[model samples]
Every structure is written in C-alpha cells, then in structure tokens.
Target: MTGDQTRKLALVRNEVDLSEGDFDPTLLAVRVEEAARRLSIGRTTMYALIRDGAVQTVPIGRSRRVPVQALSDYLAQRMQSRPINAVA
Candidate 1:
C-alpha cells in the first residue's frame, strides 16, 4: 500500500475508545477534519464515508459532529457481526 494508505491503516488499527464525555450530543458539532484525524482517515475519505453512510454524522448549523457513542457502537457492531472460524 502507499504511504497515505499505510498511515490511514495504522490509525485505523490503533483506534481509541471514546469516553462518555466525548460523545455527548449536547456538545457542538465536531469539524470533519478533526474527526477524520481521530478516525485515522484522510479528509476526503471521511467525507466520502459520510456521503455513502458507512459512518454517521450529526449536523449542527453549518457543521457536523459524530456522536462518540456512535463510533463505539459502530465498532462493537462490526466486531460482533464478524463470523467465527474454527481453529485448526
């Protein structure tokens, strides 16, 4: 993979769990740039994901904020949805 791809991969592989406060909906919308950085994705890719609905976004005025719990929920759902394989 290319350097940008690798960097993105590294970020994805080392995702941080969001704490209670980080996800409060009452907070102002988070900018796409910061969210992309936190999620380890390029800004364009994050925008694309938002466009395609792979990830969720909350809009406040002219900006967007992803609820912290949504990220945790997304990860948990992905993990749980994976199929188990028998160990040889």
Candidate 2:
C-alpha cells in the first residue's frame, strides 16, 4: 500500500480500537475506507456500492461518511434478497 493508504488504514484501525470500549453514541458515521473494512470489502467495491445506492452516505463538510445504520440496513436487505441454502 502507498503511504497515504497506510495512513488511512491506521486511522481506521484507531477508530475500531476506540469502538471496542464504551459505546460512543455520537459516532454515527465512519470514513468510507473504515466502512469498507467493516463490511470486509475492498474500498473500490464500497465506493461502487455507494454509487449504486446500496449503501447510504452523508456529507459532512467536504467528506462523505457512511452511517452505521446504513451498513446494517444494507446487510438486512441482502439477507432478505438472498436467503441461505440449507444442505439436504
């Protein structure tokens, strides 16, 4: 990864570490890269999802952030659309 990418990843890691402690109700959103990490997806894929409206984002200043509820809603929608198959 490039230096910029490394720095972004470190920032995401720090946010995650903070989340492990007491829940911060004020943290309603996260950086796109951090959201991608939470979804176990590539940054590019996350952006695509955002573009396709599969994930919702809010504009904060000049940056766009994905709301925590948006991630949950996306997962819920996916689960409804694609049911798990059971072995016979």
Candidate 3:
C-alpha cells in the first residue's frame, strides 16, 4: 500500500478501536475494510456483500465507502429476516 493507503488503514484501525458500538453517522462514510471490521466480518465477505448489493456503498473518486446508515440498515434487514425461537 502507498503511504496514503497505509495512513488510511491505520486511521480505520484506530476508528475501529475507539468506537466499539457504532460509527458516527455524521461522518460521510468509512473505508470498506473498516466497515467490515464494524460488521465483525472479513474483508472478503464485505466485498462480496458489496458485490451482491446487500450493502450500499458510495463511490468517491476511485474509492468506495460504506455509509454508517447502510451498515445499520443491513444489520436491521438481517435481524428482521431472522427467525426467533420460542421455548416451551
């Protein structure tokens, strides 16, 4: 990775460490890898979700970012579709 990329990755890592609950929605978006971290998934899975249109992303120049709302929306959709079990 170039210096800029390295710096961005470091920033992502720091963001991941600082905000354990959720990202700040006031900010536009986070890097794909950072979004993956927030979702507790791997980068490959995040990319696949993006490719499959399961997660929404914004394109800024050559970089793609996942909005904080998109992550929350994706999790909400998953939770809504999940089946709940009841014990007798």
Tell me, what's the RMSD of every candidate?
12.8, 8.4, 6.8
Write one digit per residue (lDDT tens) for candidate 2, span 26-69. Answer: 45788887788778789999999999999999998898999999
lDDT tens digits, residue span 2-82, model 1? 986665554443342433224323333355665676666788987887787867888766767766665566667766777
Write the candidate numbers in order of decreasing lDDT. 3, 2, 1
**TM-score of every model versus the real structure:** 0.51, 0.69, 0.68
Tens-digit per-residue lDDT, 17-51, candidate 3: 53466544445688887789888899999999999
List of clashing residue pairs for candidate 1: 23-68
Model 1 residue runs over 4 Å out of place are 1-29, 83-88
TM-score of 1: 0.51
